[model samples]
Target: MTESKDVNAGSTASKERVAQFNQRFDFGSYAETRQFLDELAELSKRDDYYPDVSFGKTYANISIDGEGQAALREMNSTFIADMQALVTKTKN
Candidate 1:
Protein backbone atom coordinates (compact mmCIF):
# COMPACT_ATOMS: atom_id res chain seq x y z
CA MET A 1 0.00 0.00 0.00
CA THR A 2 1.18 3.51 -0.75
CA GLU A 3 1.55 5.98 2.05
CA SER A 4 -1.21 8.58 2.03
CA LYS A 5 -0.69 12.07 3.40
CA ASP A 6 -3.24 14.36 4.96
CA VAL A 7 -4.00 16.78 2.20
CA ASN A 8 -6.25 18.86 4.40
CA ALA A 9 -3.77 19.32 7.24
CA GLY A 10 -3.07 23.02 6.88
CA SER A 11 -6.48 24.06 5.67
CA THR A 12 -8.92 25.95 7.88
CA ALA A 13 -11.25 23.00 7.61
CA SER A 14 -8.76 20.93 9.62
CA LYS A 15 -9.62 23.05 12.67
CA GLU A 16 -12.95 21.26 12.77
CA ARG A 17 -11.22 17.85 13.00
CA VAL A 18 -12.22 16.94 9.50
CA ALA A 19 -9.88 14.28 8.13
CA GLN A 20 -9.23 13.55 4.47
CA PHE A 21 -7.16 10.89 2.73
CA ASN A 22 -5.97 11.40 -0.80
CA GLN A 23 -4.45 8.95 -3.27
CA ARG A 24 -3.90 8.79 -6.97
CA PHE A 25 -4.05 5.65 -9.08
CA ASP A 26 -3.15 4.97 -12.64
CA PHE A 27 -4.94 2.65 -15.03
CA GLY A 28 -3.86 1.15 -18.33
CA SER A 29 -6.65 2.78 -20.23
CA TYR A 30 -9.77 4.88 -19.94
CA ALA A 31 -11.91 1.76 -19.98
CA GLU A 32 -9.98 0.35 -17.05
CA THR A 33 -10.40 3.60 -15.19
CA ARG A 34 -14.15 3.47 -15.67
CA GLN A 35 -14.24 -0.12 -14.59
CA PHE A 36 -12.29 0.72 -11.45
CA LEU A 37 -14.65 3.55 -10.68
CA ASP A 38 -17.61 1.24 -11.06
CA GLU A 39 -16.02 -1.22 -8.64
CA LEU A 40 -15.38 1.57 -6.17
CA ALA A 41 -18.99 2.67 -6.46
CA GLU A 42 -20.18 -0.85 -5.74
CA LEU A 43 -17.99 -1.12 -2.66
CA SER A 44 -19.04 2.29 -1.40
CA LYS A 45 -22.68 1.39 -1.88
CA ARG A 46 -22.23 -1.81 0.09
CA ASP A 47 -20.52 0.04 2.92
CA ASP A 48 -22.89 3.02 2.66
CA TYR A 49 -19.80 5.23 2.52
CA TYR A 50 -18.86 7.41 -0.38
CA PRO A 51 -15.74 9.39 -1.21
CA ASP A 52 -15.18 12.42 -3.35
CA VAL A 53 -13.83 10.90 -6.58
CA SER A 54 -12.43 12.38 -9.74
CA PHE A 55 -10.73 10.79 -12.74
CA GLY A 56 -9.30 11.59 -16.11
CA LYS A 57 -8.53 9.31 -19.04
CA THR A 58 -6.30 6.93 -17.15
CA TYR A 59 -5.90 8.15 -13.61
CA ALA A 60 -8.15 8.54 -10.61
CA ASN A 61 -8.03 10.67 -7.50
CA ILE A 62 -10.02 9.51 -4.48
CA SER A 63 -10.58 11.46 -1.30
CA ILE A 64 -12.34 10.16 1.79
CA ASP A 65 -13.39 12.47 4.60
CA GLY A 66 -14.76 12.14 8.11
CA GLU A 67 -15.50 14.69 10.85
CA GLY A 68 -15.44 13.05 14.28
CA GLN A 69 -13.07 10.87 16.28
CA ALA A 70 -14.66 7.49 15.75
CA ALA A 71 -15.90 8.38 12.31
CA LEU A 72 -12.42 9.45 11.24
CA ARG A 73 -10.82 6.20 12.34
CA GLU A 74 -13.48 4.05 10.76
CA MET A 75 -13.57 5.97 7.52
CA ASN A 76 -9.80 6.08 7.15
CA SER A 77 -9.24 2.41 7.90
CA THR A 78 -12.04 1.18 5.68
CA PHE A 79 -11.11 3.44 2.82
CA ILE A 80 -7.45 2.51 3.03
CA ALA A 81 -8.10 -1.19 3.10
CA ASP A 82 -10.62 -1.16 0.32
CA MET A 83 -8.57 1.16 -1.84
CA GLN A 84 -5.45 -0.90 -1.34
CA ALA A 85 -7.32 -3.97 -2.48
CA LEU A 86 -8.60 -2.18 -5.53
CA VAL A 87 -5.18 -0.87 -6.41
CA THR A 88 -3.69 -4.32 -6.12
CA LYS A 89 -6.35 -5.92 -8.23
CA THR A 90 -6.10 -3.30 -10.96
CA LYS A 91 -2.33 -3.61 -11.15
CA ASN A 92 -2.46 -7.32 -11.85
Candidate 2:
Protein backbone atom coordinates (compact mmCIF):
# COMPACT_ATOMS: atom_id res chain seq x y z
CA MET A 1 0.00 0.00 0.00
CA THR A 2 1.13 3.53 -0.70
CA GLU A 3 1.96 5.74 2.25
CA SER A 4 -0.28 8.74 2.77
CA LYS A 5 1.94 11.77 2.51
CA ASP A 6 -0.94 14.08 3.24
CA VAL A 7 -1.85 14.49 6.87
CA ASN A 8 -5.49 14.68 5.87
CA ALA A 9 -5.09 11.10 4.63
CA GLY A 10 -5.22 12.02 0.98
CA SER A 11 -3.19 9.66 -1.14
CA THR A 12 -3.39 8.21 -4.63
CA ALA A 13 -4.79 4.86 -3.50
CA SER A 14 -5.97 5.56 0.02
CA LYS A 15 -9.61 4.45 -0.05
CA GLU A 16 -10.69 8.03 -0.55
CA ARG A 17 -13.85 6.97 -2.33
CA VAL A 18 -15.03 4.84 0.56
CA ALA A 19 -17.32 6.21 3.26
CA GLN A 20 -15.40 5.28 6.32
CA PHE A 21 -14.17 6.63 9.65
CA ASN A 22 -10.53 6.36 10.60
CA GLN A 23 -8.38 6.89 13.68
CA ARG A 24 -4.91 6.12 14.99
CA PHE A 25 -3.77 5.72 18.56
CA ASP A 26 -0.38 5.56 20.20
CA PHE A 27 0.32 3.38 23.17
CA GLY A 28 3.15 3.30 25.69
CA SER A 29 4.46 -0.16 24.88
CA TYR A 30 4.05 -3.28 22.82
CA ALA A 31 2.08 -4.99 25.57
CA GLU A 32 -0.34 -2.10 25.86
CA THR A 33 -0.85 -2.00 22.13
CA ARG A 34 -1.43 -5.73 22.02
CA GLN A 35 -3.97 -5.51 24.83
CA PHE A 36 -5.83 -2.76 23.03
CA LEU A 37 -5.91 -4.82 19.83
CA ASP A 38 -7.12 -7.86 21.72
CA GLU A 39 -9.93 -5.90 23.32
CA LEU A 40 -10.90 -4.49 19.96
CA ALA A 41 -11.07 -7.97 18.53
CA GLU A 42 -13.32 -9.12 21.36
CA LEU A 43 -15.58 -6.14 20.88
CA SER A 44 -15.84 -6.84 17.17
CA LYS A 45 -16.71 -10.43 17.86
CA ARG A 46 -19.43 -9.51 20.35
CA ASP A 47 -20.89 -6.84 18.09
CA ASP A 48 -20.62 -9.01 15.01
CA TYR A 49 -18.81 -6.19 13.25
CA TYR A 50 -15.19 -5.84 12.31
CA PRO A 51 -13.20 -2.83 11.35
CA ASP A 52 -10.00 -2.70 9.33
CA VAL A 53 -7.11 -2.68 11.78
CA SER A 54 -3.41 -2.15 11.31
CA PHE A 55 -0.91 -2.00 14.11
CA GLY A 56 2.69 -2.07 15.14
CA LYS A 57 4.51 -2.27 18.45
CA THR A 58 3.07 0.88 19.94
CA TYR A 59 0.38 2.12 17.61
CA ALA A 60 -2.84 1.10 15.93
CA ASN A 61 -4.85 2.38 13.02
CA ILE A 62 -8.55 1.63 12.78
CA SER A 63 -10.90 2.17 9.90
CA ILE A 64 -14.61 1.57 10.29
CA ASP A 65 -16.70 1.39 7.15
CA GLY A 66 -20.08 3.08 7.28
CA GLU A 67 -21.16 2.53 3.67
CA GLY A 68 -23.06 5.87 3.85
CA GLN A 69 -25.94 4.46 5.85
CA ALA A 70 -27.23 6.45 8.80
CA ALA A 71 -27.63 3.41 11.00
CA LEU A 72 -24.19 2.16 10.14
CA ARG A 73 -22.71 5.61 10.74
CA GLU A 74 -24.24 5.72 14.17
CA MET A 75 -22.98 2.26 14.93
CA ASN A 76 -19.53 3.23 13.81
CA SER A 77 -19.61 6.24 16.09
CA THR A 78 -20.62 4.12 19.03
CA PHE A 79 -18.01 1.55 18.18
CA ILE A 80 -15.37 4.25 18.08
CA ALA A 81 -16.46 5.61 21.43
CA ASP A 82 -16.37 2.12 22.87
CA MET A 83 -12.91 1.60 21.46
CA GLN A 84 -11.80 4.86 23.00
CA ALA A 85 -12.96 3.53 26.33
CA LEU A 86 -10.82 0.47 25.78
CA VAL A 87 -7.86 2.72 25.12
CA THR A 88 -8.45 4.42 28.42
CA LYS A 89 -8.68 1.08 30.12
CA THR A 90 -5.42 -0.05 28.60
CA LYS A 91 -3.72 3.14 29.67
CA ASN A 92 -4.55 2.45 33.25
Candidate with maximal lDDT: 2
Please provide, for model 2 over 1-92, each residue's C-alpha lDDT reduced to its tens digit, 9 standing for 90 to 100. 22347666554334546656778999999999999999998888776677778899999998765442344465554666788999989999
Candidate 2 ranges with C-alpha deviation above 4 Å: 1-19, 68-77
Question: What lDDT does candidate 1 reach at residue 14?
Answer: 49
Candidate 1 lDDT, tens digit per residue, 1-89?
13235785366354445555678999999988988898888877776666778889999998765442345376554655776798778
In model 2, the clashing pairs are: none
Reference-based TM-score of each model: 0.68, 0.69
Worst 10 residues of 2 by lDDT: 65-74
Weakest 10 consecutive residues of candidate 1 by summed lDDT: 1-10
Clashing pairs in 1: none
Most TM-score-accurate candidate: 2
Candidate 1 TM-score, true structure as reference: 0.68
What is candidate 2's local distance difference test score? 0.75
